[model samples]
Target: MPVAPAPPAAPAYADPQGSLRASDADRDRIADILAEALAEGRLDAEEHAERVEAVYRAKTVGELEPIVRDLPAAPGRTAAAPRPEPVPAAYGPEDVEGNADQLLAVFSSTTRKGRWRVARRTNAFAVFGNIEIDLTEAIFAQPLTTINATSIFGNIEVRVPENISLRGTGTGILGNFEVTSLEGVDPQAPLVVVNGYALCGNVEARPKRGKWVVDLQSKIRKHLGH
Candidate 1:
């Protein structure tokens, strides 16, 4: 008599009760579903944003289930294969050498904006002039970027996209040092840290309105011409 064939092994994280811990890939998949819903007019921008935020905050598969339970099933999504994590566009050491890491403005206004590669660390100095560093349309070479700003009788303003994280550890001496801290919903979003001093001048860091980083998966798909 022939023996019965062995039972198929369960898929990874195929808990019928959905009690397994969620991974980054899990969150990303749920986020993609929400994005599709928004695009189809099933969810408004506000609702989509809120659900995306929840997707990142979910710690378990159970928590992620309710986020898109009402949405239509995603196309081509299967449990047979695990979703791959997104790889962001990063600059290598050779690429870093080509990007400007320092900005100086002495008695003249200077600005660094548009589609530029940002280094891991940047130094900005403003003396009796204005220096503006806009990262709304910039490419992040790394996950975290530090900006060392110094203003002496001048001004230094740093603008970042609204969807990226922003932090400040700078101080003001007989001047103003202001930074509007923000925490982004996407875990893969870039982080900007501003640190330095402002002496008899102004140093400000804030999010640029109506500017945001595209969805990580969406960006990757576009790069692959999908």
Candidate 2:
């Protein structure tokens, strides 16, 4: 029998807490390593973008591994940020932006339950929350926006403007859905909807690019009460 091609080795992911011990300099060294890979074409631009984002988000060499998996090694890669020694400490959700590496953001609020605006940034982002979420303006600011949510457990709702494309994944379990500015959409850029068991809750997702993957396993038939 013929042998199959080897799979792409998974890169090492830095430890989640490695960020606390790493100085800005240390962070840059990590970034430089991957930047070299992107420039060499070992990894795609989107892959490179995610890797760069992870470096700032990462706190340990283990966390860096996944980021390191895709890039090609270059003969010479220079530093854009300084290198610092590693140290260890605790971390909080709000303290995330301080490492000079902010890939994802988390905002938890539950007061009046009013509409909230999604801030615009050049990077890729997603908003998953209850009914107190709105991003009509963000759709305009960013050409691409995504909403990955679970509504049955919590109310994750969002309003988007026209022009930008949208896609989705859901069990349609609770009232989880994605809305666009209009009904007419390009065949190439079709809106998607998914429901695994149509249970009580759902995991919804909509991204600017790339397809969503589902890997769920459960004995749902046994619970159907047949």
Candidate 3:
């Protein structure tokens, strides 16, 4: 029999968070990085524009890696050896982690949404109650945040905006633990890891909508200098 070829190793820059989404700010940061590279003669103008367009269209960090993989880091930065895999740190220095926060609901319902600062580590609990966490307008303390949640005879729900990445590894024992956003992730985007257990209850994660409208409104306000 002929020898079978070994499978290729996975790219290291591949988004470990899985199908998480990207954000406008994430895209802008990459664009800035590309712009800097262009000014520094690391990338030609054509390549820079092309990469910027792709950056805007990119829904995840995985899509943004190849654009600058071959370019050298800024003048002051130490360049690491090149590999066949993608490198998350090569993108820039803005993707740092944040502090820690917590949320809990016991025999009642607790909801957190709107614009708020998220810690690097967040602990959420729902015991005979309900808990909802929405990150549509959240400001993360770090580029990657971990959410540890537990639901017992209650419900725990997480709502994230599009383009942000989510890795949900929660398990359910005689209950339900579901993660709806697990496709087309970006390694450079903010990573939110959802982990925990649900007992006789439900734990779910999914994406939100209407961010474009918000973006448009912000642009209009800025255009008018309001």
The TM-score leader among the candidates is 1
All candidates in order of TM-score, best leading: 1, 3, 2
lDDT of 3 by residue, 4-92 (tens): 99999888766576345776445545655664564445666456545655765677766765556666643234578652332332122
**lDDT digits (tens) for residues 1-226 of candidate 2:** 9999999876565444444365554544555555444334565555645555566566665566556643333223344555432211110122223222112223443221123323222121223323333332221211122233434334333333232234333355454444332221321121111112222433333332222111101111232233
TM-scores for all predictions:
0.56, 0.28, 0.52
Whichever of 1 and 2 has more lDDT, that candidate is: 1
Please report, in order, the local distance difference test score of every candidate based on alpha carbons.
0.75, 0.35, 0.64
- Candidate 3 wrongly placed segments (more than 4 Å): 1-99, 183-187, 212-226
Q: lDDT by residue for model 1 over 1-226, one digit each (tens)?
A: 9999999999885878878899755765676566556545687656765776576567898899888877676433444555443345332232433343879999999999998878767889999999999999888876657687999999999999998868776679999999998876655567676877899999999999999875555765665579
* TM-score of candidate 3 on Cα atoms, chains taken together: 0.52
Overall local distance difference test of candidate 2: 0.35
Candidate 3 clash figure, as a count: 14
